[model samples]
Target: MSGQHHVMVVDDEAAARDMVGEYLSLHGFRVTLCDGGPALRRAMATERADLVVLDLDMPGEDGLSVLRDIKRRAPVPVIMLTATAAPTDRIVGLEVGADDYLAKPCELRELLARVRALLRRLAAPAAVPGSAGRTETVRFGTKILDLAAHVLRDDEGRELPLTASEFSLLKAFAENPRRVLSRDRLLDLAGARDPDAFDRAIDVRITRIRRKIEPDPDTPAYIKTVRGAGYMFMPEGETR
Candidate 1:
């Protein structure tokens, strides 16, 4: 990881963009400001951004559209910003590949912390390289999770679509197989350190991951949910 991470902020409102970008800059991040999707595209064409802070309610080509494009082109981490507290809004963003989200009028301190946590998540794998603590791959059911490549492929080597949050959550489960993980503990392990990020968000990612790796998502055999506790990944389920 570099000494200063480059973060691109995309918001329609100038005030909102300036406020967020300036705050991130003050916290030792190199900030790039863009008003909408076009500017973001142009900036991305010239230089790469370590992560993106995207606003959901932009006029033309909303945040979801931009997020889709970003994932298609580069697949960098994203933290969505929105004014609405509606669960649906955040869930939609997450489903569309947003790594995490923050509601409007957010505390800069919280955003900074979230940014640091996300960077740490991205850096953790690199720090271990090929040492004994590093995982090359994890097997479950018929799917093979490439931890180094950050991908899930089937028996035929068909890659699946997995968002950053889902990948992080799945990795956490695989690393601590058969041990019950409370929602709060899962959040910390998944690099989601924001108080505003609800535990239900973890449930959403779990549901998404279950669809990919579980034989039957409805009755998940890999990531089983304890009635009163949290989730536990069944280590014995690996067929390979």
Candidate 2:
């Protein structure tokens, strides 16, 4: 990604879309504006966008649905914008693969900070291969994580589709299995900062991961909660 990164701003609100698009353009990003999810889909087909400034509330095919679709089809970094600051909504956004969420009535400065943070994270280097004799595959329950490909798959060999952030978070936990990881630690490892008032967003992501890999998501056998401590990943076997 270059200094003149391309960003797609998806928002139905004309004023809000213009404001964000203009600000990002002024700050050296090449921005393309879209009024709805359909327009966004069209724009994506033509150009590769480095990031997305997505609005949560839209007249049709609302932001959450778009978020899920984007995560599934293309794993681009997204900063979600919503008027409601409800914790449940924020959790859902993060769970479904929004990289960051901002409440509406938000300050431009804060949004800019979040955008920069997300871009920087996406640009981070992948984990390097260790020395000879190091563990290559991480196993938890019936799932296998391939660090190099950044993918998780079940015993049946079905690949679990995960967004970039979710893959990074799972890799962090798999690399340090069976150890309690605090929210702050997980954020640092995932190359993302904790969003405002949504620290439990990590837990939500973990729950989503469990649903894919664990036999029982409600009583997860792989990633276990450690009361107030945080979470611990129980690997099938000890790391060599």
Candidate 3:
């Protein structure tokens, strides 16, 4: 992929949209501005975007709905924006498939950095055959993670769709099994955009991964949340 990517900015504030659009434009992204969800839908209908910078506080069709719609309509990466640093909004955004997020009243430089981080992560090369051996994969329970294929498959060969963040997080966990991974270290090892230690970004991604790999997400076997310490990923047979 080229360094340039098409980004759609959906914000009710015209000034915010213009500013973000122009900033991204100057940074080599082709950007489109949308005033609301309807315009967002129209733009996506016209052409698929590489990423979306969406504001959460839109009228009529809120960003959560738009995020859901985007995932349902297309699986493009999205970065959500909110005016307040509210944990509820951030957590909800992640649950609804936003790839990353930033609080409003943020510096343009920070936003640019986050955009680049996510784009770079998305552009990372997949695992491919290089040696005279089978492609390396890790097994947790009945699910096998094809590191090169970037996919999780079941014993029955059913595929689970993982977002870029989830895939990266699971890879990190598999590589460092039986170790308590702090949220900061997980983000660092996973090549994710660093959020605050208190941010629920890492937790949300972990939850999503558990839902796929665990027989029961509520009480996970592979990925266990260690109270106040972080999380530990159990390697196969460790439980016994």
Instruction: Report the Cα lDDT for candidate 2.
Output: 0.78
Query: In candidate 3, what residue range of length 10 has the lowest lDDT sum?
Result: 190-199
- 10 residues in a row with least lDDT, candidate 2: 126-135
Candidate 3 lDDT at 92 equals 82
Flag the better candidate by lDDT, 1 or 2.
1
Model 2, range 1-240, lDDT digits (tens) per residue? 435689999999899999999988888889999999999999999999888999998986999999887877776888898898677777778877887777887788888877887776556544534724453567767788766566678877778776667777787886677788988788776643546643677777777778877887887777888888888887753332
Prediction 1 global C-alpha lDDT: 0.81
Backbone N/Cα/C clashes per model: 0, 0, 1
User: Model 3, range 1-240, lDDT digits (tens) per residue?
Assistant: 324688999999999999999998888888889998899999999987988999998888889999999888866788889986667767888888888778896689988887887777767654534523567778866589877677788888777666767777877777678889898787775543534534477887887777778888887888888888888889763662
How far off is residue 67 in model 2, in Å?
A: 2.1
My TM-score estimates for the predictions, one after another, are: 0.84, 0.82, 0.84
What lDDT is reached at residue 73 by model 3?
85
Error of 3 at 49 (Å): 2.3
Error of 2 at 167 (Å): 2.1
TM-score of 1: 0.84
| Superior candidate under lDDT, 2 versus 3 | 3
Tell me the tens digit of each residue's lDDT in model 1 across 119-224: 7776667212344666577776668888877888998999887766777887887777778899888887775445555666777788878888878899778888
